[model samples]
Target: MTKRSSPAKTGPQHLVLLAIDLLDSSLHYPGDHPPFESFHFDIHITSKAEDEKSQVLVTVKIGVHNENITRQLGSLTINCTFTMNNFADVVRLNADGQPDMPDDLIETLHSTALSTARGVMFATFRGTFLHHAILPLIAPGSVTEEKRL
Candidate 1:
């Protein structure tokens, strides 16, 4: 059965960020093109749980593309590992016997990971052609909708 027992207010105290790693990133500008008139962002999120170790890894990948999206301006991929003190209690097997994660808990992790990527993107793109192109504040619900895993 799906576990819905996790408290809605799963605060930061229950989750500890163990690490943040820049799995990949790239910046490229077609030299002759006019300064990006406008750009779009493509974001992807995925999560893996190691319940035995009370750890969860959330991966956030963002891509910056030109107005037409025919070309990619830049991209960033970040992986965040978090430790939950109540992992066993929070994550439980669903009716299918597959691990089921609480929505609140998943949102929390995705938010944090995305925010971290935003900051890192700013720093990494600083002094570059895409310097002014910053990641906007994303609602967790919108972000979670893109999650594939």
Candidate 2:
């Protein structure tokens, strides 16, 4: 009888967690607009699992408060999970053909946050500032230096 060989293990040894806090003084346009002092915005990204079998999951949360309204605008949360393989592919290709590092990963996340905020601003506040003005300020930059071959 022939012996069967065991399958090789593949994937990230440990999960990575990234947190970014976005502050927007101009979340609402017009300084005279009702002040929302209790509003809070937070985003969390987690590399749940890595390997041939699974992808990472990212969770986002936004909270707002207004003492005058019936609804206090507690917290609005959204979760997005994407495959590691897909992420890897995008990071490899930038505007120019070059190999990018994990820093690119954060940039992608920042872009996603901006997009999400824009969608929410349009739907809820009917505002145009989040996308045009606020997002640009909070966008994350490349955190690490690229290695030379």
The best candidate in terms of TM-score: 1
Q: List the residue pairs that clash in candidate 1.
A: none
The C-alpha stretches of model 1 lying farther than 4 A from their native spots are 1-13, 93-99, 145-149
Q: Give the per-residue lDDT digits (tens) of candidate 1, residues 39-123.
A: 6899998786665666778888999987654778899999999987776666664444444576877788889998999999999
RMSD (Å) of each candidate, 1 decimal: 3.7, 13.0
Q: List candidate 2 stretches off by more than 4 Å.
A: 1-47, 50-52, 66-72, 84-101, 120-137, 141-149
Q: What local lDDT score does residue 105 receive in model 1, on the 0 to 100 scale?
A: 77
TM-scores of all candidate predictions against the true structure: 0.81, 0.39
In order of listing, the candidates' clash counts read 0, 0
The alpha-carbon deviation from the true structure for residue 113 of candidate 2, after best TM-score superposition, in angstroms, is: 4.0
Q: Count backbone overlaps in model 1.
A: 0
Per-residue alpha-carbon lDDT of candidate 2 for residues 1-149, written as tens digits (9 for 90 to 100): 11123322333233333332333322323334444444434443332323233444344445444444444343434444445444343323222323333654546654564466545444544443233222223545522223223
